[model samples]
Target: MTKPTTTPAEPPYLRIVAAIRRRIADGELLAGDRVPSTRQIAREWGVALATATKALTTLRLEGLVETRPRTGTVVAGTAPPTASPALPSTPSASPVSSASSTGTAPEQELTLERIVRTGMDIADAEGLSALSMRGVAARLGVAAMSLYRYVPGKDDLVLLMADTAYGEESYPADVPEGWRPRVELGARTLWTLYRRHPWLAQLGPISRPLPLPNLMVHGEWVLSALEGHGLDPTRLFDVHVLIYSHSHGLAVHLEREAQAEAATGQSDDEWMDSRAPTLQWLAESGRFPAFTRIVGSLGDGYDLRLDALFEFGLAALLDGLTPIIEGREATSR
Candidate 1:
């Protein structure tokens, strides 16, 4: 008798891709319809966020879906290419193979710096939530297990990525004349980093700060600026926290807006426009007269310009702190 043969089970991500592909084929999901987001897929399938991301990536590669700026990922308007076999779970040996083909660099070429940089690139393009060990490995063209040889896991990799990004900027050796200018420079430098890496703002809470060496550099800059002022140690630290909070609080919205756009398939302007009816209702209700008046006064809709807001808020904060720093006020609290 011939030996019994058994087929291998499909990977979770490929299973997800097949389900979605079937929906598209059956006409249940139309070309322009928004597909389930990575989060949604994860929740529904009881799978990891990484798996969901991989499924979406596979679909995109197969030309079954495309991303739009204001709109989230939707089925491609054009016909998809001829069906292809599911991607293998492991990296393929053949150079001309499908998605699993080894990356441009061989496995031996992998280094911690290269891995961290690749992770940063992914996090830069997609929000932090989209990042995964598997995704990074796939991009690097190595097996997922190969990454463990360098960074232990995703958490450690993210920390390395954050540290590297923070280390990009440094304070000048010759400081500005006044404490205010020096403080301004430090705050602006941090803001620039946050602007470049919006995901940085989402790292941790105020109580539990990330213990990154490069982040300490920025902290040192701010503390030095406020140190010689007449304020006590407590007040000095308090003011530093306040300044840092101002930059971080505003920056939190940067990643949030990106995530929201991806999740809801709507831009800020588009989201606001969708709420027009609610706004009109609120205006006519006569309950919020001041709000209605101010909103109505604008010839064009108010544009939420974050950079302008940052500058305005920074100026106001500094002006308020001037008296405290100059010893004109008894206490900042």
Candidate 2:
């Protein structure tokens, strides 16, 4: 008799992967079609997000799916063979070249700076949530464990990345004459940084802040602008905090919008269009008369310009502060 043949049971994650693979193979999911997100997979399959993540990771390794910033994971045109090589679980002293299976070369210049830079690039292109030690290692063609040698964990790496990003621009040595202008410049600088790195806005809460040195440099700039106005120490710090909050409050939306776009696979305008029926219902309800009237009066040229909003809010905030600062100056005089 022939030897008994036994088929191994598929793991839950592999089962999820197989379902997705079947969709792709059957032409149900075409190339460039977005794969179901981890949340979708977890909900549909009654599995944990980690399992969903692993399934996606396996699919990514097999080149079935690839992540695009603000687009989530999409099916690739060509899928890798079933036996695609996996990333090494152990750290390697020398770098491994993926381009050629046989060649291994020393990473002579692999410093902490290099690791931080790679992390920054990933965080910049994909949101911070997409970043992982293994992801960074793959980008650098290094073992995942090798990253731990330079940075202890993801938290530390993010802090380093934030510091490096903040250090990109600095206040000019020649300061603008007025406090208002100086504060405006400072706010705009911080805003520009947030615009460039949307993920940076999601890093910390206002109550508890990361004690990153370069970010502190920005605080110092804003604080220095308020110093000569004769405000009390507490008042001075409060003003600084307010100015920081003005910029930061608006900036937090940037990453959230990016995440929403990726998760929904819809751009902001597309999302708004989808909600038109609900908005129309609200308008027809007539309860929100003031809101409806203003929205109706708003011209076709009306655009939700964040930069304009920032400037308007900044000006209003500074206008409120101006009287306080000038009143203090007069009171002291």
**lDDT of each candidate versus the true structure:** 0.81, 0.77
Q: Which clashing pairs does model 1 show? A: 103-141
Distance (Å) between predicted and true CA of 220, model 2?
A: 1.1
Q: Write the per-residue lDDT of candidate 2 for residues 1-333, one digit (tens) a residue.
A: 899999988899999989999999999998777788766787899986567777887898898887655555779874334323232222331232232233232355456866776676667667789899888777776777887888999999999988877776689999999888999999999999888877888988877877989999999888888887678899888888889998899999888888887775544544554465577689889999987888778854247878899999999999988877766546656
Q: Per-residue CA lDDT of candidate 1, range 253-297, in tens? A: 988888887765545554565466688899999999999999999
Give the top-scoring candidate (lDDT): 1
- The prediction achieving the highest TM-score against the true structure is 1
